[model samples]
Target: MDVQILFVDDALFMRRVIRTALNECGFENLLEAADGDEAIRIYRESRPGIVLLDITMPGKSGLDVLDEIMKIDPEAVVIMCSAIGQEKTIEQAVRKGASDYITKPFKSTNLAGIIKKYL
Candidate 1:
């Protein structure tokens, strides 16, 4: 409940859906970013407890942001969320220190479960 979550996605609708899902789960301290740059800026300033990051965006892919965030704080919790479910991509994310990976079009309960796992 107290833990802050950052939702990084390029789509406004996706962000809204994620927010609504988490809100229903009683996660009120949520931050959002429409792109990688803004996500990085917000992450640096706020240092949220958990980050739900998307892989695709206009600039600076989610993997790039993940690398930067890891450099900033090795212990930071970052979960990758994207429609791309390629095995190689997931492996790369995990290798880069992602806490977990969630494929898009996921159920709200599943997302909540993942978030709760890390918290």
Candidate 2:
């Protein structure tokens, strides 16, 4: 509901930062998950319209979650977020049904642009 978005990251700071960026871009319905397992649980329950996943998390990792999400819904809209140097992981996520991959340290404009494309 309300253009739902779920954001998964082990770091609370990163979650807040991305949530804030999305809010600045006029997005309001945001959910937060601290790890991949929790992200998967929430995804099944809430069925958010969009998901933003961080690749390097505590357990299961983003790619693992992406696979799980794809299993649940082949058409799931997922955007993988990777750090500056994780090209392989990003590529793998894309191959596994992620809608796109966004390199970390991104500007609000860039993130917003990606979301707009999905919208």
Candidate 3:
């Protein structure tokens, strides 16, 4: 696909897993950020079509990044990724303008499906 996607997570392993999954699904235009600051910087510079953001990170948390992205572009498609039992945080993220969310330990097919939904 031509659409660019931003994947933000503090864990290198998690980023790699997501990248591998998306790559298998034929999504080659992907970007990665280890923390929220970089994610925002890239979002500002690149304006990607979608963002797969981890809810908890070392700095500036995913929710904070989501807020800023929403401010930058209300129509931006941001899908939050969080660990299990973060329903409240997930709800808060949605309220802050996240397009959708996926829990951690997600299946590759499900992740690809969600991205395709926005596309």
Candidate whose TM-score is highest: 3
| Residue runs of model 2 more than 4 Å from their true location after superposition | none
C-alpha lDDT of candidate 1 relative to the true structure: 0.93
**Per-residue lDDT of candidate 3, residues 1-119 (tens digit):** 88999999999999999999999999999999999999999999999999999999987999999999999999999999999999999999999999999998988999999999999
Candidate 2 lDDT score at position 34 = 95
Task: List residue ranges in candidate 1 displaced over 4 A.
Answer: none
| Top-lDDT candidate index | 3
Task: Please list the residue runs of candidate 3 whose C-alpha ends up more than 4 Å from where it truly belongs after superposition.
Answer: none
Q: Give the deviation of candidate 1 from the true structure as CA RMSD.
A: 0.9
Give the clash total for candidate 1: 0
TM-score, per-candidate, Cα-based:
0.96, 0.96, 0.98
Q: What is candidate 1's CA lDDT for residue 107? A: 86
- For all predictions, the C-alpha RMSD in Å is 0.9, 1.1, 0.5
lDDT of 1 by residue, 1-119 (tens): 99999999999999999999999989999999999999999999999999999988888999999999999999999999978556688789999999998998888899999999998
- Clash count list over all predictions: 0, 0, 0
Model 3 scores a C-alpha lDDT of 0.96
